[model samples]
Target: MTLQSDQKEFRSWLGTCRFSKPADNGETVFGSQAVPTECKAVVAIWADSEEQYLNVLSLRMERYGYGIIQVDDIMPAPAWMVLKARNRTGPVLARQVSAEFPFALDLIENNPISQDDNVGDDKTLKVIVTTTLHRVEPLDAQFGVFPRKTLPEALTEWFFGPATPNIFANRADTGNTDDNPSRLYAVLDAGKIPNLGELLSSSGLEYQCLFNGKTASELAEVAPYLVKLEDNNSFTRQLFSRGKEPWFLWDRAGGIFIRTAATLTELRKHLRKFTRINRGKNDWVYFRFWDGPVLNALLRGMKSKPSHVATFTQCPKTLTFITIDPLTDTANRFIIDQKRLAGAKKQPVTPAALIDTVQLETETQVSTEKRLIIEAHREALFTAPGPDDASMELLKNEIPFLKTCGISKTQYLHDVLVFLIRNDLTGGKLSPEQRDILMHKRNNAPTKIRQLEKTVSA
Candidate 1:
């Protein structure tokens, strides 16, 4: 809001606050506050490590009232994408994500572009992020994702040391488990985590976005993350301790905790493949295997519930998946199937990335199309939306009928299946013309469904 419009929210208090002259000991005071760092934002920052980055985040929020929303360390921005981005003029942050990133940076800074600046060749590149900041909000909307007030004064804050990741994780770390034999990682659903981007910025915890290489810029802000806890760092301790309030790491969004000997890099590459799967011919859909019951059923029901050790650990056989029930300390364990570890997708999980919305088919007396139909809505069938949506038996019954109706599209068959479950209708109800419309790809299936729904409602 500009002063010309006389916006009351932003009063003209330019001359109201001024910095006082430095004292004999060089203690600078501002107005009646007698301090300057209390409510301030940092301009220059040091973000070499994840821990240092956390401090940088707090300074940005406490001073500026805006918190970081999305920080992604792994976004597969190739050379071409980077070159294309360099041509643009605004908001294209030439991050340390790719080798070609430096060229773009040089162009932006108007510096002489050089090959010598092309650094960051390690396993993972430097972190670049995206965020949505808010000016101010009610305390309720701002819970669990804001920087805490510095106690006493800024003098005491610096005189001592920096704070822990969050209020819950700051205290005694009774949850530290560095000695645990199994290296643990978690797949957290970003969709369920509350204001995940803001939480990451202020808390200063490190995480990896699971959607790598495939998507445009990896869609880092909304992918399931891979949170490796073997380091036994403060982030790990914080997550374990956060079981009570804010429910940070130990959230139950159908994601699983992994126990694998594979190095973070190896496991990431291996797991990344399973994010999307062969839904149909060239059509691919996200495979959310991290969802608890879905994974539970997928592994157990699969005929081959075996662990591919060489593919997983590069040595001995050691790979197991665990699922935790929300609000409880107990957890269930299982060995995932080897068959479906061949796909990947977007937007998921908490600390550790979750992906591979996967399924397993049993040696049942069913046709190929029926299995495909079942696999298409695997998560929903396992956990139906409501009581009326419970149509496993009805769906099973209608699969063959749907096949006979020549309704090849999974979505159309699914709609017809639901209609059969809800209404007292048979294969006879669907008009031949409607079936023809649904069966043909060029025809609009939704319009036919709308007509059917209208007819039923009438």
Candidate 2:
């Protein structure tokens, strides 16, 4: 199994990252699909932005523990990923990929990335910075001192415009190509935008909240808003035009966008059909299609079942979905051409009345895929940082023992492991209280482990 982490966001990737001397920009990692756990593991450090982050970082690591790291790989993050996962993945990734810098420890602190220099980069888009270190020999020979590549111009232009291109750019109809179909609009989660409802109210742009009618009055602040943008519109221009007003869209990506020619009311009705789905429980469940990756899966589900596509999509022309996975700094534009799909367009089904048994079954299958994607990202969100190769080894051995204690939740389990690694809990003798706290049935696992996580984090 291969491990990758951007800062402390630990995850399991399906291949190896081999580090030799500085090669083609960031395309350094290589080898077979499966990595041998026993082979000497290599660590690569990166700085994702076109700023001082990398320079400041590598200088810091240069002074640590015999100063074994060399800073030479200044290639693009996409190239790095291509070489690393080339076995299983192809060149589906576009111009956007991240690179980050070397790390330091005041025993290695929080946010882990430096945010001190926020002058002109206030609205600069961010990509997660991943680094790894192992107990490999001749570490200095493997790494060399070089610059890291900046985020690609084409990808940056997608969110930001050509003259004013960015991830934080608020301008609509900026990046459309000849292949793009239908009108585009984004359903934004209000939580990410400061005073989102207020902004929408003041702006002349057409918008409708996810929770409309009665729910709109009560849960407006919490609801996601579907916004339709017009080119050069004053309200849209103001979103990212403020000097250095942090590139908010690329920062959190709190929602997803849709491409359809249907009017807002009709489009909303088409989507409302799937919002309330009946799983095995026989009760209606709210499916959050507007939030990031699930919409991608929802579109995929609609594509496979042409009947649902016909029944739901209001526009007979085409329906293309664009979702940006902030986690990977990747944006996927999933298209469903209605003209190509089989079956006649069915009448719009109200949220409550769309509950046919066969449709419900199909919806359940779609929900399952959505759930799996959500779980995988959730699992990858919180993992303990590997300080050394030995920590990783101990971590693997410690998991089975911890499972016996009922710590199965991903974050909780990792919390316990992080505590163990940091405190050398297993290497040294455990206090009776500590041992009891871990294994005791009366105290309950979550409560006990939560306290331990606090200490580890502290």
Candidate 3:
């Protein structure tokens, strides 16, 4: 394509551009024969601005599978007057050109220039213009709003002007692409006695309670707003449905949802007391019991005319719970011992020091049996013959017991060589030939194992 200074023209040569459309049976039909004349153009322009260029390019490439036109070469206007004239009018012409045209620019800044060309008095600029028509496929009717620029007409009027247009003057704003905020829900349970409302107010923990006597079906209506606490366990559901005892619910970080049949009275009496006693302490206490049966026992104990009395107590330093396990058919008791900071203090160690201590402990804890097995393998490999057929056969036979004991061939060979060199098994008695063979086998064990695998697979 050719663009010049004096005249408002751009010329382009498009050779054999391919176009495709899906047939009724979903097969793609290509070339000028399948497309209409008006739908086709010698040079197609898809965008004028960068945003438009990106939108059009994305649509053509991703949606319609169309390839953008690529420029082969750019030639500058020869004379200084011609260069100035073309630069003045190039940007205006560029906006009118279709993106499918090799010479089209999303913005005038995209116009090509010859690096060797100069506007100085000593150097002359040279312009080359080529225009050719190849098969033209119809442009999609959906994209007809964009105008097409004739390559020859755009290129011919070129003698004297500027080379590139100033692009920032007419730039369009593209807004920020931040994502929308996510919806959040609070967990709650239906309750009555020591009511959820009264409990929430007393406990000072943030919570939202659903209405009492709300059925599972009614709860389902607000499912999106209700964060669930129970998984496969249906005890909480039963308490919400049948029991008059108050139930509590709360959302915990890391997706831990809490639901219990313990009343605000029992919660304040037991769980909350634990939190309060440990408050401001450098240590914390955690429960080591199941929830379902414990809550069942507590609720059963709280009945107005209860058959069995469930006694609960919390010490300033400890909390205890006694309950029955229906699955095991036995009574269980658990204690939450208070944890407190020690009065004695010591200097804190750096991470490097901690790592060194751990590594030393690990090294000291290596099993004696493992050490003996490695030593045995090392002695066998060190004393074995050279790489002769008979020697290899004998060496292989020596490791059958080791293999059955779960040592890998490569690991066995590696341990054998390492132990031999360490003077742990061979006591540094290895001859030059034995030492060389053992080292060679250890180094090449991986390759040897691969060959063995291939042989076994074959």
Candidate 4:
């Protein structure tokens, strides 16, 4: 299908979306819009590293409103085709899984150009990513697909800060172990429920059981119903709901898995995690947790979870060479708070209130300069709205040419005098001779104005 069709189908599958109001009755201040749950299918990839793949997976999954659960000893397949397979009978169908990415090359090439553009396009550059998904044996426990070079370290650092590389790297190293030690896997929510049993059973391969629980075998029974290969390059994971229900897809032994109480909640939870891969800050890994059963399932299922070492240290150290603006400073402060909440080592938290106060004081100094400019303009107005006879009564009734010029402030008074002399305005205000002199200076400036002023005054 075309992008339009894809989007349309996606929205239908996603269900009616809803957003939370500001400061809604939730622990978190910002409200979130609900993501559609009825995924058509899910895509998975066997990327090179969990860290790098997370970023990539986050992009793809987030696009379709999917989430990711870290699976131990299981690597996610790259590019699970979320859409239906067009024609399985075709010979090409045997080699690849899904349709080739529409603009893979154009996308990759245009990335740098977009980044340098600095306008809105530059922001897209950060969001667009390359993920390496693998078409590998289902039973094999050791494999990764994301190309290392595709991981843009500099770009990640620039957009997310220092911690991002390590977070990516850390995620990459997640699934590996001693024997079948390193299993790499991540899941995508297609937002449409598909026949998981038919998809898996038709793959012509035995389901690889990776999770360990009382219902492990029973869970495997439904694995096929929950997943499908759209083509060689992609596969989809699906879960449909009757009403409020919980759906789970996890490793058979004990590894990364995701479960949602409600189909919609599951999809939203998965999408939240899925899209978060690219949400890494300038240098740190900061992920928000999904409330409810998804969180409980992850805590219960995973044998071991990832840590945030890279996250804590990713912050930019006090710089001797660089200066941070308020925006960057706000981010830094937020990172500090996030790390603290994540149970990382504590750091000095510069209260935002303090920062606000400092900013206010500094702004006052800047505002003073502006005030002076306004005052100077006001003084200049005295020339146009001439001084009243009440003040001019002392000096001759002649208007001061400098004041009459309507240039405000004492500074411009000197400039106007010189301006008059430069034009050979040698006549004084009262005498025609002086008036002529003044007129001479009026049409001249710099040299003649200064010289004539001196000659007349002498």
Candidate 5:
């Protein structure tokens, strides 16, 4: 049938259909006006010619919103084609005209129209439309498909699915093992822990050996003086007095512990010192909790589940490390208080932050020098010399002129070498000693530039 005839038949069928319309606007036909705010609606336009259908669809989408209708030529037909045709068919076609107001699942079951539903008087076109009183989940106008899973699984899949690469595999080796493990995992919050590995990978922090646990006797057998529990807690003090080292009481089956000469006190002291010297108050301090269950899950490549690590926060005045006794699962906490040593106040900002500023100044100086050199040697540098002897004489004369231009010997040599190389001036180039000097200057250009930057900054 013609496109005009098909459209007229569809409109006639639409007029007879009982569906809710916006009370204010009198647009009864689909794609006639702006989609009603009261309900999410999709209109499927069909014609014998794909071009005609698409043309109408584009016009409607442009007039309305792009996503108002749930059809795109890029998408697969069967995934969204709710109605199907069977056996012999002529130019006549049937398109399902269902009002899935705020899209729902039982649409087919609750739909009043059937495949057998008749279109009055029009044999060439049939539009079987059904309107449901009940509202389904809100339709994503852009993507009409409703989520098949529950909210949590949907959210989990959305976040850690194929898009986010598994980053737990990138963790720095902590020498953890079944026998002589070198790390402990502690669970902080189960919910916020899933993306901790990604967070750490992006933070650009250098990995350091932070803590170690070993029996006092075992430590004594190796280096006893290095292992000391300097925790201010009374319980820890009492445990130490009783010669109860943390590793001695460790339950092999319950929790993992590392055996090393490194002490927690040393780690804390190092961090405190580093922060005092390098980090400002505005800089962030990150924390990671290594709990057994969460660690196992991460190692097993299960990123969808919650991780044991906590989110990084601003550095606190004091950091509390909690150790769970494997035997009783009771917590033994030790606080690392940030000590304000005498000369640890904020100092004058250094040149490290001014690297960009110094770089800009260096670039400007180099540009100015290049301009001066180009102007001074425009004729000798650019023009072809009379002969080999004349070119050699010109190069020899320019050497003194180059040095007097306030350019460093290294820079002068570099510029001269570049000019010679570009101009093919090397018939039997400089002597080995001169070549070596040029090579040295070329290699040390970066260092020279750095020194120049320092001088300028100072």
Candidate 6:
């Protein structure tokens, strides 16, 4: 049995570029003609663009009944699975195998990972800045290295000519690659954009166009929009201190790279007042807040073009609602809505509503009172049979000796004791001698009422 089990586990190989579906019975995989006998698991690594990698990993885990866990920089040995090969025309064998993370490369690097610095202080601003550059006209372009100090020559030309000299100089000044500046517009979406006008004016940075390629001046135009603070915990401290928000670190199949998402500070501030926030294991973030008030305010905002307005004279107290959306899908559509205190003001909309509100009283107290009365009646039935003449008749009937011993029935009270004495001497079984001795014992028995009472009490 053990050998057969080993063969079953080791029958298939590690999947490479493709995956196989589970069998019709949904117990295990069936198509293994293409699988190698010695393989157990497959591993793959992707570049920094995580969008494609995340989808592939999620699919493989679901199809193979395997779990997804983080692995280290150094990958596993590719050829370590040959011990499970099966013997043909023989009993089956199964072997157990699993994925592993070796100790050497599994440890995370020591380089500092940035975290949020915002706390009780709310004045700091963090912004997602997007800049749009337009050319006076079109021109040809080429890539060349520029000196670090030159106004435009030192800057890397993102787009070639066919653009106006003024606009080309502006795009070159900031190292911007997009020729169509209208397509790239920046906004203060999540973080604080503190005193935007001041930052732009103080640095003399031109939002329209810059003749001199000044990276610092352009950053100054963008800086007021970013959350400002002096803490080391700030995520953009290195970016802010070095004056390089627009520098390209590297390039991949997609394009140039920079970190420009909503800062953790902005996200927390937006979601803090919400009643619930769900961070699911599938890498999604959802929020639920008081919806009734927000919806009415939104309606008012729609009605008034340039200013805030009121949609209703007074707010209702009963209705409450919330929403949920995934983090990756930022287009703001809710996956679920939980409503509380719903339709409280409606007047019997359905028959079921009326039934739910009906009140009924309990009958337990009344039933308990009737049970006690029945018990009292049962006690009255046993009171009539007193222990006197009836008791004397019953004793004589059971013993049968007093009537034959020539004792009067009135004297049965005395004869009862005499019967008891003879029965005890015969060990509760009557003998011929005990019957003859009964008369002798009867004369010796207690005769007076007071003496019989004393003997009975003893």
By TM-score, how accurate is candidate 2? Answer: 0.46
222-341 in candidate 2: lDDT tens per residue? 677888865455444443221234433344556776666667887676666565666645665666667765554444444334445556553534455556544334455543433333
| Candidate 6 C-alpha error for residue 278, in Å | 22
Model 5 residue 339 lDDT?
Answer: 23
Question: Could you tell me which 10 consecutive residues in candidate 6 have the lowest summed lDDT?
Answer: 329-338
TM-score per candidate, in order?
0.34, 0.46, 0.15, 0.17, 0.15, 0.17
In the range 252-355, model 6's lDDT, one tens digit per residue, is 00111111122334422332322222333443221211222232223222221111111110012111111111111001111000011121122221222211
User: lDDT, candidate 4, residue 3?
Assistant: 34
Clash count, candidate 5: 6
Task: Kindly list the per-residue Cα lDDT of model 3 for residues 108-181, writing each as its tens digit.
Answer: 22212234432332111111111111111111222253343211122111101121111111112212111110
The alpha-carbon deviation from the true structure for residue 447 of candidate 5, after best TM-score superposition, in angstroms, is: 73
Between candidates 4 and 6, the one scoring higher on lDDT is 4
Question: Least lDDT summed over 10 consecutive residues: which range in candidate 4?
Answer: 318-327
Per-model C-alpha lDDT, please? 0.39, 0.44, 0.28, 0.26, 0.28, 0.24
Which candidate number has the best lDDT? 2
Q: For residues 58-132, what per-residue lDDT tens digits would candidate 5 score against the true structure?
A: 444334322111121211123133222221111121233322221111111113233353243211111111111
Question: Which stretches of model 6 miss by more than 4 angstroms?
Answer: 1-49, 65-197, 200-458
Give the range where candidate 3 is weakest over 10 consecutive residues by summed lDDT.
Answer: 248-257
For all the candidates, what are their Cα RMSDs to the real structure? 25.2, 18.6, 33.8, 29.7, 30.1, 37.4
lDDT score of residue 132 within candidate 3 = 16
Among all candidates shown, the one with the greatest TM-score: 2
Which stretches in model 5 have alpha-carbon errors above 4 Å?
Answer: 1-22, 30-42, 45-75, 81-199, 202-458
